[model samples]
Target: MEIFWRIFDTLILAGGFVYIFIRYGIPFFDNRKKGIELSLKKAAEYEKEAEKLYEQAMDVLKEVKSEVENIKKEALKETETERNNIIKDAETAAEKISGNYINQAKSEIDKQKKQLFDEALNMSFKFMQDIMQREMTSEVYGKINDSFLKLQEEAFDRRSNK
Candidate 1:
C-alpha cells in the first residue's frame, strides 16, 4: 500500500508539470507566430506599393510616347505645308517668266514687220522716180512723155481689173 501511494503521488506531480508546460509553452510560441505574421503582412503591403509605383511609371512612359508621336506628326504637317507653299511660289514665278518671254517675242515680231514695210515702200518710190526722170530727158521729149503717160494709164487699168 505505501508503494502504490508513492507511485500515485509522483504520477499526479508529473501530470501537473506537463499541463503547465503545455499551456504556457503554447502561448509563448503563439506570440512568436503573431510577430512572423505581422512581418509577412508588411511585406505584402510593400509589394502592393511597389506594384502601384511600377504601374505609374508605365503610364508615364505611355504619355511620353504619345507626346513624341504628336510632335512628329505636327512637324511633318508643317514641313508639308512649307513644301506646298514653295511649289506654289515656284509655279507662279515660272508663269511670270514665261509671260515676259512671250511679250518680248511679240514686240520683236511687230518691230520686224514695221521695218520690212518701210523698206518695201522706199524701194518702190525710188524705182518709180528713176523711170520718170529717164523718160523726161528724151530726144523727142513731148512724144516720149506722152507715150510714158499712155503706158502708165494701161498699168493702172490692169491693176484695177485684178
Candidate 2:
C-alpha cells in the first residue's frame, strides 16, 4: 500500500508539470525569443546607420580641410600682390621726387648763369665808358697825334734811304 501511494503521488506531480508547461511556459518562451530577435535586428540596423554617419562626417571633414587650404593659398597670393603693389608705388614716388629735384637744380643753374652774364655785362660797360672818357681827354689825344707824326717821319726817312 505504501509503494502504491508513492507511485500515485509521482504520477500526479508529473501530470501537473506537463499541464503547466503546455499552458504558460511555451507561449512565454516564444514571445521572449521573438523580442530578442527583434532587438538584434534593430542593433544591426543602428550599426549600419552609425557607419554611414561616420563616413559622411569624414568626407565633410576632408572637404573642409581642402577649403581651408584654398583660403590660405588665396591669402598668401593676395599678400604677395599687395607687397608688389606697395613696392611699385614706392618706386614711382621716388622717381618723381628725383625728377623734380633735377628739374629744380637745372632751373637754378640757368638763373645763376643769366645773373652772372648780366653782372659781367654791366662791369664791361662801365669799364668801356671810363676808358673812352679817359681817351677823349686832351693829353691822350696829343699823345696819339705825336705817334702818327713819328710814323710819317720814319716812312719818309726810309724812302729817301732806298
Candidate 3:
C-alpha cells in the first residue's frame, strides 16, 4: 500500500508539470516562431531592394560610358575641322602673297625696259649729232637738223601715245 501511494503521488506531480508547460511554454515558443518568420520576410524584402539598386547603378554606368564615347568623337571631329580650316587659311595666304610678288616683279621689269629704251634713244641722238658735225657742211647740217628735229618730235608723240 505505501508503494501504491508513492506511485499515485508521482503521477499527479508529473501531470501538473505537463499542464504548466502546455499553458505557458507553448505560447512563448509560438511567439518566438512568429518573430523569426517576420524577420525572415523583412530580410527577403531588403535583398530585393538591394538587387534593384544594383541594376539601376549598372544602367547609369552604361549611360555615362556612352556619353563619354560621344564626347570623345565630337572632340575629334571638331579638332579635325579646325585643322582643316587652318590649312585652308594658310594656303589662301600663300596664294595671295605669291600673286602680289608676281605683280610687283612685272611692274619692275616694265619700268626697267622703258628706262633702258629711253637711254638708248638719247645715246643714238648724241652719236648722230657728233657724226653730222664732223662730216657735213654748215648748209647740209642745217637741213639735216630740221629733218632730225621733225623725226624726233614724231617719235616722242608715238611713244607718249603708247
Candidate 4:
C-alpha cells in the first residue's frame, strides 16, 4: 500500500507541472495570464465601440427618413396651392369674358333698336308728305280738312257713349 501511494504522488506532481507549462507558457505563468487578460479586455472594448457606432448610424438613418417625409409633405402642399391658384385664375378669366360678351350683345341690341326706330320714323314722314302732295288740289285739300274734323267728332261721341 505504501509503494502504491508513493507512485501515485509522483505521477500527480509530474502531470501538474506539464499542465502548468502548457497552459501558462514555459517562460512565466503570471506573465502569460496577464497577456491573455489584456487581450480579452481589448476585445471587449472594441465590441462596445462597434455597438456605439451601430447605434449612431441607426439614429442618423431615422433622422434622414423624418426629413424626407417633411419635404414630401411640403411639396404636396405647394402643388395643391398651385392647383387652386390656377383654378381660381381660370374662373376669374371666364367670368370676365362672359361679362364682356353680355355687354357687347346688349350694346348691339340697343344699336339695332335705334336704327329700326329711325327708319320707321323716316318712312312715316315720307308717306305723310307723299299723301299731302297727292291731295294738294285746292278743292281736294279743303275737303280733306273737313273730313278729318268730322272723324274726330265721331271718335269723341263713341267714347262718351261707352
User: Which stretches of candidate 2 lie above 4 Å from their native place?
Assistant: 1-40, 127-162
The sequence of per-residue lDDT tens digits that candidate 1 reaches over residues 1-162 is: 999999999999998988887888778789989988999999999999999999999999999999999999999999999999999999999999999999999999999999998998999888878987776665668787889999999999999999
Note the residue pairs that clash in candidate 2: none
**Cα RMSD to the true fold for all candidates:** 9.7, 9.1, 7.8, 9.8
Worst 10 residues of 3 by lDDT: 132-141
Clashing pairs in 1: none
Instruction: Tell me each candidate's TM-score.
Output: 0.51, 0.54, 0.55, 0.55
Q: Alpha carbon lDDT of residue 70, candidate 2?
A: 100
lDDT of 3 at 74: 100
- State the local distance difference test value for candidate 4: 0.92
Question: What is the overall TM-score of model 1 with all chains considered together?
Answer: 0.51
Backbone clashes, candidate 3: 0
- Give the C-alpha miss distance for residue 119 in model 1, angstroms: 2.3
Q: Write the per-residue lDDT of candidate 4 for residues 95-118, one digit (tens) a residue.
A: 999999999999999999999999
Every candidate's lDDT: 0.92, 0.95, 0.94, 0.92
Q: How well does candidate 1 score on lDDT at residue 116?
A: 91
Deviation (Å) of 62 in candidate 3? 1.6
